[model samples]
Target: MVAPARLDLDQRGDTWSSLPDHDVDVLVVGGGVTGAGVALDAVTRGLSVLLVEQRDYASGTSSRSSKLFHGGLRYLEQLNFSLVREALRERELMLTRICPHLVRPVSFLYPLKHRFWERPYVTAGLTLYDSMGGARSVPRHKQLSRTKALRMVPGLRKDALAGALLYYDAKSDDARHTMTVARTAASYGARLLTSAKVERLLREGERVVGAEVTDVESGETATVRCRVVINCTGVWTDDVQELAGGRGQFHVRASKGVHIVVPRDRINSETGLILRTEKSVLFVIPWGMHWIVGTTDTDWDLDKAHPAASRADIDYILEHVNTVLAHPLTHDDIEGVYAGLRPLLKGESESTSQLSREHAVARPQPGLISIAGGKYTTYRVMAADAVDAARPDLASNVPESVTEHIPLVGAEGYHALSNQVETIALRQDLPAWRVEHLLGRYGSLVEELFAMWAEDPSLKDPVPGAEEYLRVELLYAATHEGALHLDDLLARRTRISIETKDRGVTCARPVAELVADALQWDSGRVDDEVKAWEARVAAERESQTEAADQEANAERLAAPDFRNRSVGRALA
Candidate 1:
């Protein structure tokens, strides 16, 4: 196995200095899960690869997902059986072989409104769901009587359902998973550059050769030459394709999905809830210490970076979810709200739900391939397809993607280490639950945290305001996990930003202090970082109160991005 490359400031400097000198085999132009996956697939295939992201990794749709890695149960109704089967297979791979530490089984109860044919019909669909693609790790669906269902979820309205169907799905911390994938790719020798935007596609007489990249941090431009470039820019797929000198083979429409996070106690259910809505499905998902209830599938024509969930969106979710809850959730019950855009393949149907989730890979021009419009569950398949599209440009024999067999860095020996969590906690003089928490996030890689703890036992102390995460983990995020800013640490490395009641504001200053030295931020710079994060949180909160897209978007953009100002300040 190749040694993982350090992705800190030192390595970033070294990588940037050396980038122009080498002819990269593949250059991936996005840093979402799909782009990260493509980089991993390409690097493992014995190719020199580089991946670049404009913002922090997974800051886009990848981070804002329902956080499930599931075979979409609703897809069965559409007769998209193959898509369901393929997704199930990927879910199995994630649960068992690849990143078992990150992905785990989560059960959801589907309430049946109709008394008659619903039971048999739903049971048949679930049976196919279980058997398809040889899914074994997750248990099959179980039919429960209305009484049993009510007992399981006391918060659920007794009249809401005649019965219920319980089935297994899987979920992960999507942002963390995406970052791990990027790090795994780096481990296999892929140079990763975040905050780097591709300004233009460099072409030699229309055969695309490379990209002119702008280091968004410093405004430094570098012409990165590559044999083939793969565009995995999700919602920005069309924009990237246009930069490559061609309108893409297929268009991608953006579907906005909004989710509100409420405290776990707000709902009395032991398991998650899935409800059928008029436009699409609604999920009352079980997040740690919180329940993520969401997702309106309306078309989005506004800003892609920060998709704001308006008051109507929140009301829509609450109204639909309240239909089944004994004590209906109010605006005050919501702790956090987030919105993400889905890059759905454009269909003739006006409804976004009717649009296809299946991805397409097309070499719209020589030396360039674009992959877009896939669900998060099927990212590996999309990556493989994108890599396959680049085969024509390669003179050397490109090896097939072996990502299925490759366990992510932390996945190796994760289960065995989990069993010894109590022992480790005893030795480290920490609580067992804290050890378990670290194990779940870092897997076998928790040893790094332990080593840090060994150096300074104070590292075991929890972060101020956000006690769920230890101080040492914040340090690790900066020193090891390539967290470039306060947002990276608060938002992705740890979910303090969205998970907390204050939206990480109270902890922002403490977290900034924790990584200030590592990131070489002066006192003023640290203060600026904290203020920027606070402003961002404030903007998001204000946006949620607005009624329409225009007003909501305007509210969201009210806060200036700290990164942009910081970059300019540094350069000056």
Candidate 2:
């Protein structure tokens, strides 16, 4: 079998040099999960493909999701059965066949309020949810008494629950999952480019034949030719649609969802909690060492790129979540906070929460196809639909998407590697738990890390400020994971940005230096990268203190982007 393509700097240069020589069958704009999925789907169908993103992969909503692969239990209240069924099927695929290393089953507790009706209501919904996709991997819903519920979650006030019901869903690190999808696409011969922004659609008369892509890192431009261009720009869907010509068929409204991460000790619960709000539902998800409690759904009109979690947003989440807690949490308990925008298909409803999560694919013009408004769980389905929509422009017998049977990289030998974690740990001279951690994050790819460590014994040491990660991870991110900027390494590649209390500020310099070695950067470039990342974290913290969205946006925009700053300084 051909070795998987490495997305290092060397491969990036080779990809750019070869872009002009070949006519790609599909040109995918965006680097989120949906875009990555489209690239994989198109390429596996025997099509030459090129995918470009303006920023790091998953820097947008793809990274900042609620981090759940749930079937949307709340959707059942709206009676949206089809959407739920599709999502549940995808969730199962991720857990079992696709990327099991990334996605895993998680249980959530639904506290009962009324004595009689609530138990039956929640039980019925969960039963339907379990049987929807023929799910067998996760355990089915179990009914619990109030005494049992209180025993499980001692942090919850005794008065809060009449009883409870436990049900299973799934979760993953959103950014990691998206990046894995992109890497999987690259493994199948799809050309992946980051920091390559589409300046304009390259159109012949009225049909978009290709795109004039500009390198954000350097002031360079290239016109990439393709048979069809698929736009999967999420919240920026309307913007790209306008560039293609006009908004076709529908409009996408941005809905902001904010989540706060606190240390797990604060929430003394064995299982995650799902609470009902006046408008929607709230989830307290169990992250590794943290409890991610949040998500306020509201309309957002300000900047889609940098969706800030304002003081009001943070307070709103705390107030709602604190209602049932025996010990109330304050700002001091929050280690990390993040906000993401959902691209909802607009409807007559005034509330953003009421907007349909269903997606739409359209052939706006001859060579241009756009897909918008789908959940992260259903990205595979969306990709298949996008490719199906481009059928007229593609070959008469373009093979159907076969991604359903294809497992992502690192998934092939994962189970065997998992069983031998202790042996691997002993051989590598690391703790068993540390080896387990690496397995979950990298799966069978941990062998690559071990190989690197043999070459340089120092690579096994933990990072200076962040002891949870190894120094080799930084090197791996820069060398193999297409992490171009320091922000890419910290924010998306590792999630050190939002997982740490200091927002990765303390480890920024050391992490930058480690990446610089892999990327062959000079001292001045390292300094610039570190400075840019520090400024970004500071801006996010400052923005969170602001009371309004406008203020928060202005604060966030004040920080110079890492790429633009480096480019400007180099030119000067």
Candidate 3:
């Protein structure tokens, strides 16, 4: 076996093409959760896999989630039994067997309007939800009186509901989990490349054998051969299928879900609050130092790449969430704003919100398969099914997926290490909170981060602007994770984009420098990286101000690559 390249080896070019002129067992497109999971599953089963993405990993909808790894409680309201059961199982698998470090327990209070009727109604649903996987490790729902609910979530309006239901769901940093999955896949032996767009699918008669991919970073193209090509492009499933010669069995519709991040102090909350909106659900989720309040559902017809959160969209969130807050939050309270497109299964509906989150898998042709339209909670099932669909085309003895049993890179022994955080902190001479923070993000892998700091104590300090994140993390992003661009390091690898006031603009150059040194990038490359990132921020800011989705799409598409040097002091 070829030794795995250090994840920091600038995963920017054709690592696959260098080895041999051979066909891989599977080719997975899209680097979102599903695609990443599929790569990991396929590789674990002893299948040679090659996965490609047009942009950075998690650049699309996968990164911009409400950060929850929960079974859809709202879906229970819709009486979608099968979907709920499947999601609950995946949620359990993630929390228990897979990504324990990345996925954690989060509690939400469900406000009940009509004192008696609502409580019983919600309680029955909660009972069944908890019953899935037969009483999860997390706490079951507790009935809260109106007064008790108010105390738990002080922000809720006084007269909104007679009572609320407090239930347990899972939440995660979506980008981190997605990247870790890809990294885990790499560790197991999968060749994954980001910013390498599939120009066209390579085919044998009507069946896809592989893809003709173009490296978006280096401007190089390579023909990668594979036996089965799985399209897991989320919202871009249709596009990927069409590139595979229009053979995919199902189509995906892009539903826009926008989220806003605000300071924690804005709303007093003992538990994260989940409320029902007219069109969708609104969650005041408890993120580390902030509260994630948002998710406006609307149909998106504009730019699939870089979907912008418009003023109206922001207003819609602020308006609805404000109604529930004791002290209403405004534009001033918004620390970060992001929008993601959901790949809802296309069907007969003008409203995207009503569409199903259930995933569809198909072997449209002999060697081509596509999986699309599922919530993050169900990504594992979606991926396993994709691999199952590709089984007939595979040449090797297909082993059953072991991902359900394999812990992610940082997950193994995480619990024991977390208990020993204080000892780890004292030995390392770091703050207990800081060490704990590292453990939360990296799990047992906190030792790796501490080791990086040990080699050079200077790495212990935080970045100039994004102090919430350490400088060592930037180095780790490139070295241990396959971070190829400045934006990739900051935006996906770290929460710098939402954590800071400048939205990672101020730290871009320094972070770029850190990445360049690690990747051995020359001066010309540094300049290019910096320019592209600045342009990306500028384009996003410009796009957010547009009147409608079309105009916003037009403005955002103007900056294809994220590193434009132009554009100044923008209102985030």
Candidate 3 regions with alpha-carbon error over 4 angstroms: 1-5, 10-20, 563-572
- With a 3 Å backbone cut-off (N, CA, C), the pairs that clash in candidate 2 are none
TM-score against native, each model: 0.98, 0.98, 0.95
| Candidate 2 lDDT by residue in tens digits, 1-572 | 23556789988888877878888999999999999999999989999999999998998999999999989999987899999999999999988989888889999989998998878888889989999976777899999999999899999998898999989999998998898889999998999999899888888888889988888877688989999999999988888878876547778899999999999999999999999999898999998889998899999999887898899999999999998899998999999999999999989999998998999999988898989898999999999999999999989999888989988888888889989988988999999999988888887888888999999999999988778889998899888889998889888888788778998989999988888767878988888888787788889999999998889888987778776935436423
lDDT of 1 by residue, 72-178 (tens): 98899889999999999999999999989999999999999999999999999999999998799999889899999998999999899999999999999999999
Query: Cα deviation of 79 in candidate 3 (Å)?
Result: 1.2
Q: Give lDDT tens digits, candidate 3, residues 306-364.
A: 88888888889888888777799887777778899999998898899888788888888
Spell out the clash pairs found in candidate 1: none
**Full-model lDDT for every candidate:** 0.90, 0.89, 0.82
Give the 10-residue window scoring lowest on summed lDDT in candidate 2: 563-572
lDDT of 2 at 196: 91
Model 2 error, position 425 (Å): 1.3
